[model samples]
Target: MPSNVEIKAALRDMRYLTQRAKELSGTDGTVIRQQDTFFKVPAGRLKLRDFQDGTGQLIFYERPDTEGPKLSNYSITPTNDPQGLVKVLTDALGQVGQVKKERRLYMVGQTRVHVDSVEGLGDFMELEVVMEEHQSREEGVTIANQLMLELGVKEEDLIDGAYMDLLLKNQQNAHAP
Candidate 1:
């Protein structure tokens, strides 16, 4: 599995953060609207990312649900038939949750800085420091930490779970009358 050091946090100001990220980044960022549909799986978390350009990818990933940066191992499969896949997966594996967001992606060295406006969940930031096949997890974590500090991510705003998990929790609470 390919790996990266990842962190997620509550975003206070997307505009300010994006400007800071642009200043710190070497390349211009790309913004895209995304819809992530998660499905129940026997092992690992699975989701398909559907983009506005009709492109999609199925991702299966596993990472420790801990605050701060952690190593995430993942596999991705490109898909052309996302709608069909969603229908089949929903019937077979059951749909778990979904997240819709507008994401601004910026690359700082080998790390990806994400400023996202998530529907229902408000603003958020995520960092993914891509690791080389020969790279140690510690090295990736260090990169993530350095970038986090550079981008003004505070320790208190760190979160352990994915957006889908948070959305699911909110849904459960809403129905727990």
Candidate 2:
């Protein structure tokens, strides 16, 4: 696996290469989209037996706050688990529910956009533009701008973090009220 810095450099180079390819082909110039399915398990319950995909994306989970939100650390996800990981999670949570599947479309100059359907959380779309390298902040913003234009994503629709964070916030709000 590449270090963070190396990964970032590679991504930057990839973006540049993609742009050149588009220019040559006179294409609109966007990266091909990839899809990931997540089976969310309660924290601390993940294990080798619990995973089927063998691969995972470590997400920097976050929660909402006045200034925006705070990082809630990373969540490791198995890449592909067809053996009903969601069912296992629901059972662990002691809830008779279904798993949520999301299809995310990512482009070079845009926030990550996903069409998601949760068994209990309902159907929703989410957008997240990640900032990786220290030097690529400006470039990331520019890419986000272009993606917004191409994908018709609005500024107001931009989200701070993941669905789990939103769900936790709502639960807290309900308890408070």
- Which is the leading candidate under lDDT? 1
Q: What does candidate 1's lDDT look like per residue over 97-145, in tens digits? A: 7899999999898888999999999999999999998899999988999
User: Residue 175 in candidate 1 has what lDDT?
Assistant: 98
> Which residue pairs in candidate 1 collide?
none
TM-score of each: 0.95, 0.41
Give the per-residue Cα lDDT of candidate 2 at 84. Answer: 58
User: lDDT score, residue 39, model 1?
Assistant: 95
Root-mean-square deviation of every model: 1.2, 9.8
* Residue 134 alpha-carbon offset, candidate 1, angstroms: 1.8
- Report the C-alpha lDDT of model 2 over 111-176, residue by residue, as the tens digit: 444344434344444334555545354564465455444544444544553444455666678899
Q: List the residue pairs that clash in candidate 2.
A: 53-80, 55-79, 109-143, 109-147
